[model samples]
Target: MSHTTGADAKGHYFVPAASNYSTTLSIGIFLMALGLILKVNAMPEGAWAMPLGAAMIVYVLFGWFGEIIHENLNGSYTQWEDRSYRTGMVWFIFSEVMFFACFFGVLYYARRIALPELASYEEALNPYMGFTAAWPSSGPMGDPFTPMGPWGIPAINTLLLLTSGATLTWAHWGLIKGNRSHLIWGLALTVLLGAIFLGFQAYEYAHAYSELGLTLGAGIYGATFFILTGFHGMHVTLGTIMLIVILGRCMKGHFSEHNHFAFEAVAWYWHFVDVVWLILFVFVYWL
Candidate 1:
């Protein structure tokens, strides 16, 4: 517990002491997912699960990260450990890329192949009665609904995200240049921009459901629209929280020019979010 280095006297690789963080994290994720499923099915039991799980996750993250921060400040980590962290983050981002790719694939298949194939069938042969294969269509039995247009909030949000990316890059530059004020200001602006983007998205969702008659049940278009955008919004929320934490650290003089992998990791995730949003805007909104 009092060791000054991540390794022991024998110079073995560092292995952290076992903890319940992973177990609790798993439970939290499970409960949250279960709660979503239950609520979507209109079940009343497990109504409290999602919020409780979210609270648990927040608690775990704070406690876990606090311990790690302490360890880092104590000079416990070595170059090997830093390299491992970077490698792990890279793989994690790759997994996320694949996750989104699957959803995008589904959207592509539905739009390009599946819908047109359905359209090719004769009326008598069509199972969907009056189904017309069209982009932004609700299936045959789907209710009448206006599709969302991209020029309004979506366009604005895109600009906000792009600006946030630039601001974050400025913050990184400030960190490297040892300009504390610049770093703090850049991070602050980036976080503000991310918050504004989320706010606009929320308003857009409300408008979609209320004015445009768009919802998950609005069939393929609505489902795909929400699925893609909703997940991206969630990522933005997480990224904003991470930025806020980084801002707090910056104010406290936590990172040096050469030793800020945590900041770099968050920056990587933020940039990934920005790229994903650009693709989403093009394929889901513009197209």
Candidate 2:
């Protein structure tokens, strides 16, 4: 939103103020997505707009979120505001869930339906595709690329995220119990774990590309695997950043046993990301 929204004539309704942030955010997101689509399809235009949009979005998020925090510190949010924020956060998470579902659904359709149909076609009619439908499959035009195993970095990442979740919960408990040290320690540990997970993921990507011949162009297998895990990694990065910010807030004597909606909201988002990664681990890696 461009400005604060609350307290209208209709029994405490939302009010919308005109601001450029909304328009900027929308345009930047549109350009980013458009650039990505075009670049993915090998367009010849200036596809660098994607990174430009990404940079704009980062700037916007920081500015807008900082404004919100300032408002909160000034005692702008009330119980009613908290309720509204909770609802908004819930819907936001649902949107993210739907977003990831589309990718997972596409992966499923490709593996279970499209690949089978392509494979079952007559060899005389479709001689190009040396088709065989298999899990962790490279499509007919793909190279003989090897898939990654779950027993290595992925498994380690799984444990890291799972432990982060536990630490986050411990932090939440500490917050509710008025134990600031415990809360700060837990958040610090969680952030450390998240960074370790990212480090391992980077190494895994290097290993995959250099050793296993698993570049994005390696075929459907590589595309879906990277798309899923790459997006998840981005989410983890964002979540970790959020935790770091919240940790800073905690250190500065922010949040309380009774009022910490911001902290709770970020924790909810972190847990949601964690759950999504678990599903990805099992479906994309082990399965």
lDDT of 2 at 108: 92
lDDT of each: 0.90, 0.88
TM-score for all models, in order of appearance: 0.92, 0.86
Question: Candidate 2 residues 1-287, lDDT tens each?
Answer: 43333332333433334557777888889889888888988985436879888888888898788877877776655567788899999999999999999999989999899888887889888775566787788787877788998887899999999999999999999999999989999999999999999999999999999999998887899999999999999999999999999999999999999989989999999999999999999889998
How far residue 188's Cα lies from its native spot in candidate 2, in Å, is: 0.4
Over 4 Å off, model 2: 1-19, 27-59, 128-130
Task: Show the lowest summed lDDT stretch of 10 residues, model 2.
Answer: 2-11
State which candidate has the highest lDDT.
Answer: 1
Which is the leading candidate under TM-score? 1
Error of 2 at 54 (Å): 5.4
lDDT of 1 by residue, 1-287 (tens): 63437655655555577799988989999999999999999988568988988888988999899999998887788877899899999999999999999989989988998888888888788787656677888765566789887798889999999999999999999999999999999999999999999999999999999988998888888888899999999999999999999999999999999999999999999999999999999999888
Worst 10 residues of 1 by lDDT: 2-11
